[model samples]
Target: MPSNPYADLPAERSWRRAVVATPPFALDPTRPGDFRLSRTERIATAGSCFAQHVARVLRESGYTFYVAEPPRLAGSEAEDNFSARYGNIYTTRQLVQLFDRAFGAFTPRLTAWERPDGRFVDPFRPRMEPDGFASPEAVAAARDRHLAQVRTLFETLDTLVFTLGLTEGWRDRHDGAALPLAPGVVGGTWDPAEYGFVNAGVAEMVGDVTRFVDGLRGVNPRARVILTVSPVPLAMTYAERHVLVANAYSKAALRVVADEVAAARPDVFYFPSYEIVTAPTTVGRYFSENLRAVTPAGVAHVMRCFMAHAQEGDRAATAALDIRSEAMRTSQVICDEELLDA
Candidate 1:
């Protein structure tokens, strides 16, 4: 054997790795600074399930993130109102389309039926509220209106946090546009060509995201982006006989896209929310109701991690300072209902 560097060398000085013991996975403890949320003066959110949770927590913690509130029908409960207003617009594709229409992605012209006089009208339910057109036509007009507002909206945002949820999506065969959901989920019958399966690869997803960010920057030069891969699995899969495999493929693709984009763009960053929830070390206690629902405890843990990071970024500043303080005060007043039963 060689001398082995004089047969003895002292151990290198390193912080002892603290194990974060929790359900779902254990994380080798990280310094708060290692995962700090950058100080974004303003923020916007879009994407799927995990995005909703992020928005909810940020709002509760007094962050000023832009969330579009839909019109509610009278006598509807909070959950019902949210469902009714947002059910049709859950995914990024849908949001992009919505904004495209608002920003005039397509030129809008009055249909033959929508003549000078209001007498002529769409025989079916009018898609546009102003006139009776098919849902498609209505969506087109709304998209134009949405585009008009995009410039103003983009100017106000400093950071846009988007959670990529699914790679497998349905597209209209005739025109080749992404459908918000399966045809039947919201309304309309499925046509084979009218809707076909599309499983986007990492390159395509990265291209789409880059284009979107670039377009937004064209309007607002100061905006930065934070991207995450949603940890939620598919509700259904187009891939034959293996939804789990499909989900794995989809998430892998999204993760690659996120990392690639972050690397390519100085203004872009990737958050590790997906890894925190799905890491194998924690033993999977984060899920609820047969691995679907993310438990309250899981959410709290995630929020704690997020807040700790955010706090480190700017120790003197807090989001929604007054509102968060008020909420804390209010929560203190409300006794734990669960403990009351005990």
Candidate 2:
């Protein structure tokens, strides 16, 4: 045998050479590339608020950021950032259930929830409609159209970049339908007897991810997925653990699930947005004053790493693109999770 297994490894294998010795700005965690992306491919994104950054990067880089679902009202920018009008999909359960709902395999009983002001909102997407629907029937009609668009998104999209966001969510006790927000956060009343909190363990998340990959392929076999864990920490937690502790478990569980799914198939791959932003090399400089929002510089660095691995040899990948201007271009990116703190 060799002098030691460690001695034969490259510089990347050494923590000091790979991370500590290198400047934080130069540290790139992404692999050469798991798959290739062309500007002509139809790319869709769905996940928590941080996923918006990925969509923004695609727009800035002149990629065909596909919007499978357009706004019902002309000139309305509500669905500007998301691929679909389903709003922010914060959990794997929500992701899988989305496919199920679109294909007519899963039907939820609790369709519309009444806001305190006598208007109804889709329980799965409470913050989507600020004024709420005129009636539950209107909500149902709108959801039917939304599901059809979601179907098109799954059927025609070439690539999907899904960011895993949360593990803790409230769900129906009877049928296990995933609720994007707790009942009372934005609308409806919190019924303890009817709904319950779920801090999904690793096994459950893995199963959810597997089903999502399998189900997406069922609709479009050529569809490849680029999974990433959102680096944004949880704003609040319903669990008994402290917010910091809860955030750690949530991120760790998601990272594990993304790796598990990505390892199983060549079509699914993991990106390191989580590692790049949260790396020790950065010394927490990526986060803003609140220690929550990722600074524009941090976002640009993440995009740089993304471009390097996406498809190489392009000057635009290394050249300084106007990231701030891109972010400002779609300043209307709406994140439903922000309502959780409200």
Which structure among the candidates has the greatest lDDT?
2
The regions of model 1 sitting more than 4 angstroms off are: 1-40, 68-99, 106-151, 313-342
Worst 10 residues of 2 by lDDT: 322-331
Instruction: In model 1, state the lDDT of residue 161.
Output: 72
Across 153-232, the per-residue lDDT of candidate 2 in tens digits comes to 99999999999999999899999999999988778789899999999999999999899889899889999999999898
TM-score for each candidate, following the candidate numbering? 0.69, 0.95
The reply for model 2, stretches above 4 Å from the true place, is 72-78, 317-320, 326-332
After TM-score superposition, the amount by which residue 223's alpha carbon in candidate 2 deviates from its true location, in angstroms, is 0.8
Question: Would you list the C-alpha lDDT of every candidate in the order shown?
Answer: 0.54, 0.86
* Model 2 global lDDT (CA atoms, 0 to 1): 0.86
Clashes of each: 19, 0
lDDT of 1 by residue, 1-342 (tens): 658664443221122333333323335233344333444356666665566555555655655656333323343322221211232232345445544544567322322233333323321112213333444565545444434445455656777777788887776665555654555432455567556878877777777777777777777788888787776677677777687888889888888988888887777877777776776554676676557445555555555566656666443333433333333332221111112123
lDDT of 2 at 25: 90
